[model samples]
Target: MAGGIFVVPLLTLFAGASFPTAVAVSLVSVIACSCASAPQFLSARLVNLRLAAVLELATVAGSVVGVLLVGSIAPGILYGLFAVVLLVSAAQMLRPRRSAQPLGSGWGERLRLASSAPDAGGVDQRYHVGSLPIGLSLMFGAGTLSALLGIGSGVLKIPAMDAALRLPLKVSSATANLMIGVTATGTAAAYLILGKVDLVLAGPVVLGSVLGAVLGARAMVRVNGSVLRVAFVLVLAALAVPMGLTAFGIEIGPLR
Candidate 1:
């Protein structure tokens, strides 16, 4: 969870060597994180194919625009916006949920983008379409931030799905994982064409992340995650502070 929160900001400070370097690292993280989580999600039948597709289309479209804008945008300005985003995400994670309210109508009845899926527990849970316009709008923000910062927008997406759209936590997290890879793929191609990718530098980070994520996911199967949520929230809070400070030019060490 700390890795999820801090990796991008640390890299943004220490890296930014080239647009390609950052994008490459983001891709490695997205691929590794998504792949690691894929099986359990698949086995648990937690993914909503229809909803994922809709968001993917929007995300990929947004990525194109966002990545193109990166060359012209100023880093400090971008990071300032990013810090706000991180702060917002951290706040969401820290907020408590009222699970008792019936999650409301299933996806079919609620929003146009929602879909039903079986949870990790193998119980069929209906999820509503939830604020489709709002969710898509959030995806646009996620895409923009991702392109500017070279980080997966899952941090943004997961929370919106949970709070505004009312998707179960597990489903939102899994779907965010599904979306990250595709979003990265869109920007990565542009970075590659621009001659920004440095495979040598990217190799070790990708390798380490992939292996670690796989191990982490496997362990997730055996562990009880009830308490991990609080830990994850704290991790989010910790990462937000440094990134926010650095973005605003409040100097923080280059710990990347």
Candidate 2:
């Protein structure tokens, strides 16, 4: 979730990589992380394959569009947009969620968009999917952001599934994890065609991210959803300010 948001900035500010190179490397790392973690989520039955496939169509289209736009947009403008996205995600994470209502009659109902998972008590808990259009719209944006900024886009995907589609946090997270590799593959192809990907840098990043993701996926099953939300908020808030400043060409002492 956070890899690209932090890694791109660190690479550019400290490691002296160009923005495009950093972005490409970040996408590579995201793909590695997704590849490592998603299988485990799939084995655990946490990933919603149907939901992921449905949303991926929109995401892929948006990623193509974003990749086309990347060359035309200025790096500073991209950074500013990234900051805005991070801030919005932070606010969304901080917001309290209501108990999701049943999947009332709609496209979701017609599609049989309900799922079940075992709860803490070992009883099957059923949840319904809602707001298909809204979720798809947000997913498109998430895909665009993922391509434009070189992220996994979990920041947007999680909120879209949780808030718009009325999915449980764990399901949303796992599904997002599964979807990211596919999404990044599309963007990475574009980057490779553009000669933006730095294999030297991406090599180490991919290895580290894959290992970290495996550990994180195991930890995720044990953490409370509320704790995850708080951590998401804090991480995004911390990234947003520095990125917003960087966008305006302001360098805080030593970080530049």
lDDT of each: 0.66, 0.81
The digit string of per-residue lDDT tens for model 2 on 1-256 reads 6367667877777787778888899998888888898888788777778888889987888898888888899989988988887888788777776566655538777776677765656576888888899999989988898888898777778778877888876678788887888888987887788787898898888888988899888887687978887987887788788789989998666766
Please tell me which predicted candidate would have the highest lDDT against the true structure.
Answer: 2
TM-score of each: 0.81, 0.91
**Candidate 2: clashing pairs of residues:** none
Query: Worst lDDT window (10 residues) for model 2?
Result: 96-105
Stretches of model 2 off by over 4 angstroms after superposition: 223-232
As a whole number from 0 to 100, the lDDT of residue 19 in candidate 1 is: 33
True-structure Cα RMSD, model 2: 2.1
Clash totals in order? 5, 0
lDDT of 1 at 127: 59
